[model samples]
Target: MLKSSGMWWYEQFARYRYRQGMTYARKGQYHLAISRFNRALLHHPQPDEVCIARGLIYLRLGDLEAALADLDRAIALNPCNSKAYGNRGLVKAQLGDEAAALEDWRVALTHRPCYAEARYNRGLVFAHQKNYQYALDEFDLAIKANPNLAEAYLHRGNVRDELGDRFGAAKDWQLALLNDLSLDAAKKALFRTRRESHEQRLTEKLGAVLAPLDLSLQVERQGRQLNLLIQREPGTPVNYQDVAKLLQAKIVDLNLNWLERFRIIGRMGTGGMPDWDKVYQIYDNCACPPIYLSRILASLLFFMPFGIAAIVYATQVKANYAQGNYRAALTASKLIKWFYWVSLGVFSATASLVVFGVVLLLLRGESLSSIIESIRTMPSPRPYLGRPYADPHPDPSPQPSLPESTDSSAD
Candidate 1:
């Protein structure tokens, strides 16, 4: 009877420590939380709850080996712990063990039939393996389980495209967009596919016209504009006016509003030749609102206000440049130039005032050495206070807990 009472006391203390560890973990003091969890484990080594909690903390810290060990122990202690299995799958996936990860996810699903995360993860693995049909099935089930699963819809669209169902793919993509899915790869794939189709049609129409002139052309889409490269054989005489007329006719026939910003370049000869190339913009549409907005935001930086707006516009410049929007970048560069000049003037003025004040102080009663001594004698400022708590072990929450939401792992 006495031994049983002692065991009960130990379990209660261990539970108390575990609760304290969880509090520290929520507050982002990971190291202190892990220490408390270790103490809790020392009291009840076989408790699956402690193992699972510590395993999650290890995963957060990127200690895959320790996380795997604890998760594996938790699963062994209680095979029905769906949270443990799901987390083990995450660790295995991170470690590049896709086959084992899939099995763990399946086990998690078997334990809890409505496990949306496990279903989604299984679909990801299937997609990676090129099993599009299986992946589609899993994604469908995941979406059915949780209709708001944006990633599942995005991947489903990818599978539909892989299966050559363009109409279905478009529908799925629209649904994904409606759900506000932010999948960069999916968006890029859609853009590239559409651009290739447009290029193919344009090439067919331009091929016959170029054949008679003995000039070959290549068309490329760069961001919001099309670039046409006209190449001629060496020693061939080209009429710039005639070539421009022909290109302009073709662009008018196509009637694409975005193509109005096209650029045309002509080159002759194989090797380097003197003044053998001509480059010019086809249209004058420089008053684009996005570019104007960027420029205006950049100008505001000169007032020593809206510092964050300046940073945002600078980022916009880089993004536009990366997207091959040269006109937008050029316009935005004006703002950056103004900001540079204004900041230089401000810095110079501030430095001049500091120098004048120091000179005045020296001319008066203060010596440089005395100023240094006074600065040294000043008292240090107090450190910022952290979370306040008298005891390391606090009371536990009344409600039961499960694993943290799966969205964190997706990020």
Candidate 2:
């Protein structure tokens, strides 16, 4: 009723109330936030905004039924509202419907390819199901979407630990702490990961491996230095230098990641730290390849097919590296760079169209809403990566096709 020529006063009030609700929610005052959202709903023409806001508060308050109802209303009001779908996916996951949750997240990503929270939630479920590999992949996508997401790093570290990539896990825990200083869980996990016991275990493994050569190892300087000696049995035919070189090669073939953490200074007839350079070579060979996360982000913003390709290759670089498939990781890294350039070219064309397309639409008497819808439904880039992942849900009643996913980082 309070409309002006250029703006709707009701919309202004709705936005004001929505900001107030968000402030309250951030302060953990969910009930007050819900009240503000309800008031905003009364004046809002597009009720989905209020519905999604209220639904999120209800979800935070553990009122699953209320949250589900609000989210469903939001979806009904605006099927293209990716925020509603992502939140509903969380609700579905909590309600013991993991498959449904996955489906919702897939649809959400179809709408918004860079939805970090949806990816994070999906990763959590996968981790819970013991699908560590899939969980790690999803976490990679979440990190790519929002690099400062500490929880994603923390959980990804857990998945890496489960997969026995303790080195990578420790690195992730460190990154989590770097991003969120107050995250006590990350602090504790990192401390546990780097305890002295790890050094002690490494020392024992090295000693065991070197015993058969009539050689002894003494771990010194707090496990950073190694002292070596040969048991000079009289009339022994073995050449000490040849034995040392052979041991070094055998250590390299051991493929122990922790070996690089120490300087194996030879002593008593064996060469110095240079003899152990093979271990460092092993670390260098197995290192993960380039991620190209930022390039993939640009691709996602403009064209999803290239984004998909970039994401797959970027993820492969890490996954393959973790499994010691350095060749494959490098191959994927090269492929990602190629896709990055292709994506850039596509984005250039898309940007050119966007700058001029708006003018053409407006000149033809098209409204902003219709223009947005046209962009959302823009002929699916099927030849590249196919339509958004919104297949069909298992609801008894038929539902309409969904739009793109929503980025929680933006929300």
Top lDDT hit: 2
* Candidate 2 to native Cα RMSD, angstroms: 32.1
Span of ten consecutive residues with least summed lDDT in model 1: 283-292
> Model 2, 1-411: lDDT tens per residue?
656844677778888888899999999998889888988887777789889888888888899999999999999998888888999999999999999999889888999999999999999999999999999999999999999999999999999999989899989999998999998998888877786455456556666766666566554333333334333333434454455455455555444444443344444444433323212233443446678788788778767898898888887888988887765676788777787788788888888988798988899999999999988889865466666776586568878889989877963
lDDT of 1 by residue, 260-362 (tens): 4556667775445433344445433222213344444444544455444455566677677677674466556556666655665766788899789878888
Q: Alpha carbon lDDT of residue 319, candidate 1?
A: 79
User: What lDDT is reached at residue 109 by model 2?
Assistant: 93
Residue pairs clashing, model 1:
none
Q: For each candidate, how many residue pairs have backbone atoms clashing (under 3 Å)?
A: 0, 5
Error in Å for residue 70 of model 2: 0.6
TM-score (C-alpha, index-matched) for candidate 2: 0.49
- As for candidate 2, its clashing pairs are 108-405, 111-404, 111-405, 112-404, 112-405
